[model samples]
Target: MPKITYIEHNGTEHVVEVPVGLTVMEGARDNNIPGIEADCGGACACSTCHVYIDPAWVEKLPAKEDMEEDMLDFAYQPDPARSRLTCQIKVTEDMEGLVVQMPEKQI
Candidate 1:
């Protein structure tokens, strides 16, 4: 299992051991973490699962595709350098201990 840490707006952190092949949003959703809603079910159609990749680990993640980039345009608190849809990031052994910073809002 890979571990993921989600840091919330108020600086609270929730960590979960996520199974490989699951998306980060799924990890958060399954663990009852409060920040991700996954409104489009990982389809890249919504930005409800938006999150910020920790700066230190940003380069390790897969680059955003066109669809993800488009949807990110609608994210509530978008930051081109750090924002990403959690659904687009799959859990993997190499990604164990991934840390994500959640925005203050996700509408």
Candidate 2:
């Protein structure tokens, strides 16, 4: 299992253990993390799971695919360098202790 930390705008954080091979969104959804709605269910079609990668860990994540990039354009409060759809971020051993910040809103 990998540990993932989701932080809210108010500085609240939720840390959950996620099984390897699941998406970050799944972890959030399973743990009842407040910010990630994951409305599209990891299909890469919606921005409801939008989050901002911590600057230090941004480069550690794999590059976003074209479809994900396109979807991110619709994210609420998008940040050019850090915004990402949590559904696209698969949990992996390398991602142990991953930390992500939720946006103020998700459209």
Model 2 is weakest, by summed lDDT over 10 consecutive residues, at 31-40
For model 2, how does the per-residue alpha-carbon lDDT over 1-107 read when each residue is reduced to its tens digit?
98889999788999889999999999999888998888888899899999999998899999999999999989987998999999998888999878999998889
Colliding pairs, model 2: none
TM-score of each: 0.96, 0.96
Quantify all predictions' global Cα lDDT against the true fold: 0.91, 0.91
Residue ranges of candidate 1 with Cα displaced over 4 Å: none
Off by over 4 Å in 2: none
Q: Could you tell me how far off, in angstroms, the CA of residue 23 lies in candidate 2 after the best superposition?
A: 0.2
lDDT, model 1, position 60: 95
Note the clash tally of each candidate: 0, 0
